[model samples]
Target: MAKKKQTLFECQHCGEQSVKWLGKCPSCGGWDSFIELNQAEQESLKYLSKQTSSDKQKAMPITKIEEDDVVRFSSNNTEFDLVMGGGIVPGSLTLIGGSPGVGKSTLLLKIAGNLAKSGKKVLYVSGEESAGQIKLRATRLDANEENLYLLPEISLEAIQNEMLRENYEAVIIDSIQTMYSDKLTSAPGSVTQVREITFELMRKAKESRIAMFIIGHITKDGSIAGPRVLEHMVDTVLYFEGEQSKEIRMLRGFKNRFGSTSEIGIFEMTANGLESAKNISNRFFSSSKEQSGSCLTVTAEGSRALILEVQALVSHSTNPNPKRSATGFDTNRLNMLLALLEKKLDLPLNSYDVFINISGGIKIKESSCDLAVIASIISSFRNRPISRESVLIGEVSLTGEIKDVFSMETRLREAISCGIKKAIISTKPKGIVGIKCFEVDEVSKMLELF
Candidate 1:
């Protein structure tokens, strides 16, 4: 008698497995995402699991384990290197994801050229674009280096064979979703194919000490399009943020095994290609004449301090439900601030439709801009223009108390560099020069400054 074959179903979105098919995936809440695996795919999954389990070694004492020395090399891009934790680590797998036309492919191609110019043998593999298409881009980016080779192939076996044929130091995969393993029968970009390809690439990178960069497409929700396991297997995860119409782009790191993830890399889209933006201190805020409904604030991004402008618009609403909208800032926090203003300042904000915006394409994640938000809203309501030389750097609480934010001194220094003369905060720091500071402990006291 022949042996019975086992059946399994998996979620395409999150790789959740079940013994039987279901209408919706219980793990990821995806409707109708369960697909039954073929015999070949099922067997491949089993073999992969067994191979991983069999490789586990016996537990050893912590003192007996030896530490591995970490080595890094520059990718020749300052902003790229900064986001990659100083430099690129050999045998590291990095995944880059972003919206369409956000400069993911352009940035990597430029870096590949830089690496090739530095005398490192590099391979640029594109499963989506042809060799001629990439060559045209390379010409525009000035990335047509002698050592930079392009291969328009999708077969994993063929790619592996080519890698064996050459001594390439770094590899770039245009996308992980486009690559498929012959061992798996599922379609390319499927959950199984992505997982299998990533695992193989990771193993190859570690065994050969090759640095690999894989581009991934993001979903509608801005997450990488594939199983969650794809992110887990990589050493670092980076996301490109900026509208295509805008010239400024920011690369932020979400995960890193070698360095802190707080650092962000800023780049500018020019006629040539994406270049690092060195003088970005004044990029987020304008130095123009003072206007009502606009206020300046300083917030910290990692080790760097950024001065951003908070803009608000207040108008009487004819509808019973006043509209509330915020762009590049949290809407819920804006509502909370509006409520706080109504209760604390006796301001009739409930009858007005409030809108808030952060200047530039940058998003404000920290609460240090709360005071500035309040100031902008009030300035708009009163139709009074705030002084452009003054900066606000504090957080407001529900009890109407002004709270000091972290890195207050750093924020003040950035503001001073941008020609700011005054700063309103919860407390004054000792021995600070250049910018004058005013202390206000309560929100009611803060309104007096206006």
Candidate 2:
């Protein structure tokens, strides 16, 4: 007698597994995201997991592993190479994700062209665009190299066949969502198919010891569209974030196995191609005279400190419940700051509508920006501007006390390099030569600013 196959349901949003179908996932609260997976897939997953576990268990002494050096290859782009942790490691799978027209494709093409021109064999595979479409963009970017081979096929078998045909140094699969497997009945970008396809590519990359750069599509929620495991499977994950209307793009490493994550690469999109951004520290602020409701602060993006303009708008709320909104800044942090202002500073802020935004689409999460945020709000409420050439750097306590932050001196120096003269800090340091650092202990003392 044949055994009955068992099936399981997996949530598409959070990859939660369940024995039975659920209207809403108990783990992630996602509605109708569960997909059916037969017993075959479950067994396959177990087999793969066992194989991986066995390899890890066979690990030798740590000193023996450190004796060997990893093979690293540079794509010849400084900014790209820096974000990639010195260079790309062979047998590594990297996923680069970004919104449409944010230059994910462009950046990969440029890297491919550069590698091929430097006598390295590269295969550029595109499932979404034809050879002609890639060629047009390459021509515009002046990226015509003899060793840069282009394949506009989507079949996994065809791609695998090409991999077997030659020992290519690097392979790029543009937009992994467009590739499909014949064994899967679901669509190409479906959760099951994505998992299967990534597994195959990862296995192939490891066996061949070839570096693979796979482009991934982003969901409406700004996360990489696919199973959550897709990110975990890859060796490195990079996010290219920027405004579509603006030319400045920033590439940051969310996960890197080779090097530190405290590195960020900045790029500017020009008509030709993406170029390394110059003077990134000062480019985020406007040039005109300083205005009310806008304050300057320095926040660290990886190791680099940038001068950002924190803008706030406070107006009388017509509704009984005031509206609060924040962009590029945490809304919860804004609310907390507002409550502190009302309780400790004696400001009736709950009755007004407040909005806060960081310039240049740069998200500010450092607690050190708290002083700048509060100052911006107060400036807007009083219709007064602070000192023009000063930058605020401190963490605001819940009791409205100003607290010192890490790397306060580093932030102040960056501001000085951008021609800023004054830095209002929480605690006085040993002091630097160029910028004037003023230490303030409470938020009330800041109300006397011009």
Candidate 3:
């Protein structure tokens, strides 16, 4: 046999590499990321075989490629399907990231059961959990997946070989960080190993037209497992965002190539498994029972809109600066809103300890929550109650102006569906069907409406 040959390239970011023409990269997603290094080498047969491994690697005109019409798979939980933009696309790759004990594996196992029940072949490759452990959890979930297959393996080559031997319809790789390839000298979870393993799976997925769901661990900074490029290589990215202590879990799709990325799914975690909440709007507003400093807000996640409750408590501060804390939302954003409240309306937030919460243990990032945040603070300071039937959606500017938000139409419709009669939005009333509407450009004007 001839000697093996190798070619190298410089990483655009760190100037270290041994590959060429990688968009973004295994290390980073920086654009035009690879620079080839010319080297004298004999034409090799093995390297050529590796390059010709998949039909998806063939060159084709962009116009000739058909965008796969998006399809939905029954996630067993309607809410999960909604978050997945109707359903999981065939041959698509999904990366689900979350903290430990946040139920990442459990959620995927539940989905595997659903897929297997729907007459699809599902292979669950567990690099973290044991075969018996998954079965025990499956028993608790009451899942009936006679077609589901389980493989407790961490080696990438073994999984790839097994995949080629069968005609599985779907695959789930539990925790990508744990899986490794023997071809790479780097240890598993290292930058090189993660990249190699992911590429192997990607090649397999694209060639087989089988969708793959890979669960990932979150770093201390709450980023998905492995280098950020793992997300760029995948077709869709999802995050299971919610507090573990709370029964409510929010599944958010941050990116989707086959469907809308703006969708969100709401589920309540029960001892059995995640169950879909049909009347999510009603569930959000049900907690508002004449509670002081509690207000309703309409926010949009992906394509789906929702009404969420914002709760605030203002107490006399023993600390000179007062404690400004918030949960299920950004604390820095909360502080800026407080500053705007004080500057625009002369609210005495400096003397009070302000705490804000997005009820139901779900995080809200939409700027539309600005109005509700302001209203909650005011209500808490005044010890007053906000109208239970009213909801607010707007963004607060640094100069105390309430700005127009994206997807106002969707937000308004969600409010209406939730039985909200009055809405305070920042735009001029444009005659949306149903419900009373008030518009204000600045927070000062909004204060007058309340």
Q: Which candidate is the best by lDDT?
A: 1
Tell me the TM-score of each prediction against the true structure. Answer: 0.97, 0.94, 0.82
RMSD of each: 1.5, 2.0, 6.0
| Collision count for each candidate, in order | 0, 0, 6
**TM-score, cand. 2 vs. native:** 0.94
Candidate 1: tens digits of C-alpha lDDT, residues 65-111: 99988889999998899999999999999999999999998999999
Q: Rate the local accuracy (lDDT) of all candidates.
A: 0.91, 0.86, 0.78
Task: Give the range of the ten consecutive residues with the poorest summed lDDT in model 3.
Answer: 39-48
Residue range 1-450, candidate 2, lDDT tens digits:
998777788887767888899999887688999988766566656755775675546758887775537878888888888888889898999999999989998999999999989888899999989999999999988789999999998878899999999888899999889998776666778777777878889999989888899999898888898888899999999999999898899898989988777778899999889988978866789747878899999998666788999999999888899999999999998999999988877889988999999998887767888999999999999999876689998998888899998877678778889889888987767868798888889888877654
Taking the tens digit of each residue's C-alpha lDDT, what string does model 3 give over 156-180?
Answer: 8899888888899899999788898
Instruction: Name the top TM-score candidate.
Output: 1
* Better candidate by TM-score, 2 or 3: 2
TM-score of 1: 0.97
Worst 10 residues of 2 by lDDT: 50-59
Give every collision pair in model 3. 72-87, 73-87, 262-302, 262-303, 263-302, 263-303
